[model samples]
Target: RAYRMTETRGIIHRRVQSIIFVLIATACFLAVSVLLVFAPLLGRLAEAHLEWIKPYMGTITIWRYIIASTVIVIGLFSVHIWLPAGKRRFVSIIPGIVFTLVAWLVGS
Candidate 1:
């Protein structure tokens, strides 16, 4: 009974660690994406002297979409791979991730 309890505790500990890792990874990915993809667009809009609301109305470029899509795909991939309680194969998760991206694109 004691051995079983210790093993259960170990599993729970590892699960908690994986969850924290996934959260931090996702946050970092989003931060970098925003900095690299949106920062310049915002800077350009600021220089245009547009009104506060109009700045947000600035045209979004294809690069932004590409970067955002990449970030989302990566984030989803990490979550699908890491957050589950049991181990998953990388190949198995690809289809779900791709389907999710396609669904999001179509919905948007």
Candidate 2:
């Protein structure tokens, strides 16, 4: 009984650690995405004097392009998981992909 309990405890600990890691990763990704999305506005605000923002200004444009592409890819993949599994369900993502591509092109 004691051995079983210890094994269960170990399994639980591993699961908890995995969940923590996923949560941290998710938070970091969200933070980066949010920052990239608002980077232009932030750059404008910091244009006058903020030295730190200057270095990132050029990189932010690249980040915006990468972030937008990442979002579109993720959205397309998500459609499979979100909808009932069927050949027709995959077709649903086409409109979303089209819209995303249009928005990304226009924004850039």
The local distance difference test score of each candidate is 0.68, 0.61
Error at 63, model 2, angstroms: 1.0
**Any idea how many clashes model 1 has?**
0
Error of 1 at 79 (Å): 0.8
* lDDT per residue as tens, model 1, 29-86: 7776686667777767676875564544445445565666667777788878765556
Give the lDDT of residue 100 in candidate 2. 68
How much is the lDDT of residue 102 in candidate 1?
88
The top-ranked prediction according to lDDT is 1
Q: What stretches of model 1 exceed 4 Å from their correct place? A: 1-44, 47-60
TM-score, one value per model: 0.52, 0.43
Clashes of 2: 0
- Name the lDDT of candidate 1: 0.68
